[model samples]
Target: MPSRFTDEREITGVADLTPVQRDQLRAAGKLYDGEDLDAAARLVDDPDDERSFLGFCNLWRVVDGSEDRYDAWLYQVDSGTIFRAGTTDVAAEIIQFGLETRDPAVRAELGPALVEAGLLPKSDVSYPEFAGLLRTQQGA
Candidate 1:
């Protein structure tokens, strides 16, 4: 199965967009917002490249599209927590640790998962909790 992170994505920035390109992006963004990755890919120039594709995925997460889990991942990445929960079973334990131990490290590790899962708030969660959660989950 294709993981959320595609290997060939790129990022040329917004200035690189054209009117038609903008339209395609808008369409793709909308499709992504609607939880339709296939449809979004159709609006993009290269589905295999990282730029437009990563942008689409980022947009999807920003809009809290498709699954909340993806949003959680984005949020955590934005906050400098590079870790991802791997899969649902892995993610569940991470989240539970955050609820149980209030460990910042664990939370830091799991923060991305929360962002992907769309569970985090606008305010950045504490780093200690994230770290602890991550450690706990890792130990498990």
Candidate 2:
């Protein structure tokens, strides 16, 4: 089972997108909106229920070519959180935690965009470091 964080997948960022890419992404999987995730999260009756988790993305990247590619939402397999009597805030927290938790591996793969979005540390470290490291530097 290949995950969205799959290392071998080819990626084309937003700038290079085309109509064909849109078609390919659609074919890959339905791009669940934030609202959709929110609704689904609310329906999470059991902590182990996986179907309640849906894929959501504001960012777009075309992976591989329509010729052959994997599901854009393979992240769903690695992501999602369950309700805790619905927890502190069912709608907001589920989506927040789920997205945050699943993103590290993928966010590191994001370079300028993650930096621009302020989700990553703006520093001299490369993308992998931005995603993987804890920055602690001192001036002596």
Candidate 3:
């Protein structure tokens, strides 16, 4: 069988995959179609996974041309969840949020989150600061 994640490495065999995996694949497929009920359900079961999935969902929204909603939802995502997803955009957003308010914890948390989420190659994002780029892009 084909690998579900892009890395193409086995986290577990399909037969051994948790119900979480099966639902994730389905929700990922449904995200753009606006059928996020299952995805939302999965999130309730596991906020950690849901947070990561939401980041991917947000990315999908952006890539699929739902920019306005994406920007709006960006603020709603929990810091812990963003870190869990570890997306570069999520990291950048966190960095930007911290920069605006001068919060060290945001930057500190984002770094390890990026590493855990595989968004960054290393834990070096520990103190990464976002420029005004994201703000400008968001028209904030």
Q: Each model's TM-score?
A: 0.25, 0.21, 0.22
For residue 60, model 3's alpha carbon misses the true position, in angstroms, by 12
Q: Is candidate 1 or candidate 2 better by TM-score?
A: 1
How much lDDT does candidate 1 score?
0.34
Per-residue lDDT over 4-123 for candidate 1, one digit per residue giving the tens place of the 0 to 100 score:
222222333445444443443444333334433332343456657442344432322211123323212221123211222222121212231232224554434345434434444435
Global lDDT scores for all candidate models = 0.34, 0.30, 0.30
Worst 10 residues of 1 by lDDT: 72-81
Best by TM-score: 1
Residue-level error in angstroms, candidate 1, position 33:
17
Candidate 2: what lDDT?
0.30
The RMSD (Cα, Å) of candidate 3 is: 15.0
State the lDDT of candidate 3 residue by residue for 17-101, as single tens digits: 3454445434443432345454334333354653334332222121113221111112223211221121212222432222122
Q: Give RMSD to native, each candidate.
A: 12.8, 14.5, 15.0
Kindly indicate the candidate among 1 and 3 with the higher TM-score: 1
Among all windows of 10 consecutive residues in model 2, the one with the lowest summed lDDT is 84-93
Model 3 lDDT, full chain set: 0.30
